[model samples]
Target: MKAKTIFIVIVTVLLTIFLMDNKDAVDFNFIFVDDVPVSKLAVIGICILIGFVLGFLVGRPRKTYSSYNDEIEDNYPTEQPKSTLSDEDRDYIS
Candidate 1:
């Protein structure tokens, strides 16, 4: 089979084993709530789902300008062309 299919199969088997092992109920306590009984597998699945969602949102690429001229201008002054000839030098050249 393909590598991707093999990987998916392996992950599915591992996840199934993990869920089976963590099927016991556990008590969770939050600051604003009393103790809640929930399956360990359910809690692990929720956390993994939340982590994947957050990762996808945070890891998305942001829009950026590709061209150099498309960039934002700063307050820095650009270099001006300097004249090599003065008034006396111009007379000599003429």
Candidate 2:
């Protein structure tokens, strides 16, 4: 089998073992909160899923200025190299 398939099989086996080992129900309590009973594997798996989702959302690609500028320049270009302001406006100080 390919390396990826082997790795996937290994991970699946390990996860199955972990889930089987954590099947017992556990009581969880937070400060000032009532106790909650849930399977240990369920809590662990839920937390892992939440972490992955949050990481994916937070690590998403952001808008880049170079791509935006390239698109704008491709769509709009000035006819001349000089500024559009009049000579009086350009030479106000100098």
Candidate 3:
């Protein structure tokens, strides 16, 4: 999954660079402004940074076995059995 994500990011970056280069080919003056237009690399870098931040913010912490055991215990009762079976009923006949 990580490899696939990396591959997608690489492809997207290349596509963005291609589009930006073509778009700017006839409008070279737009690249000189600080806010008129941004470079594709900068845009991609920002996107990656935002993705990392969002992922970190939304990711859940790993649960330990003890916590899971405690949760299960809390949900289930530990009292005695509700029914009693006779010794003759212990064996099943064919």
Clashes of each: 0, 0, 0
In model 3, which residue pairs have backbone atoms overlapping below 3 Å? none
Ten-residue stretch with the least lDDT total in model 3: 22-31
- Per-model TM values vs. the true structure: 0.56, 0.53, 0.38
lDDT values, one for every candidate: 0.83, 0.85, 0.66
What does each candidate score in C-alpha RMSD?
A: 9.0, 11.1, 7.0
Q: lDDT of model 2 at residue 55? A: 94
Error of 1 at 27 (Å): 0.9
Number of the predicted model whose lDDT against the real structure is largest = 2
lDDT of 2 by residue, 1-94 (tens): 9999999799878977998899899899867876788899998888877987999999999877678778888888756577778889879957
Better of 2 and 3 by lDDT: 2
Task: Residues 72-94, candidate 3: write the lDDT tens digits.
Answer: 88988878666566666665431
Candidate 1 vs 2: which has more TM-score: 1
Q: After superposition, how far is residue 11 of candidate 2 from its true place, in Å?
A: 3.4
Write the residue-wise lDDT of candidate 1 on 1-94 in tens digits.
Answer: 9999999899978988988899899899867877899899999888877987999999999877564554423433456567788999999988
Q: What's model 3's TM-score?
A: 0.38
> Which candidate, 1 or 3, would have the higher lDDT against the true structure?
1
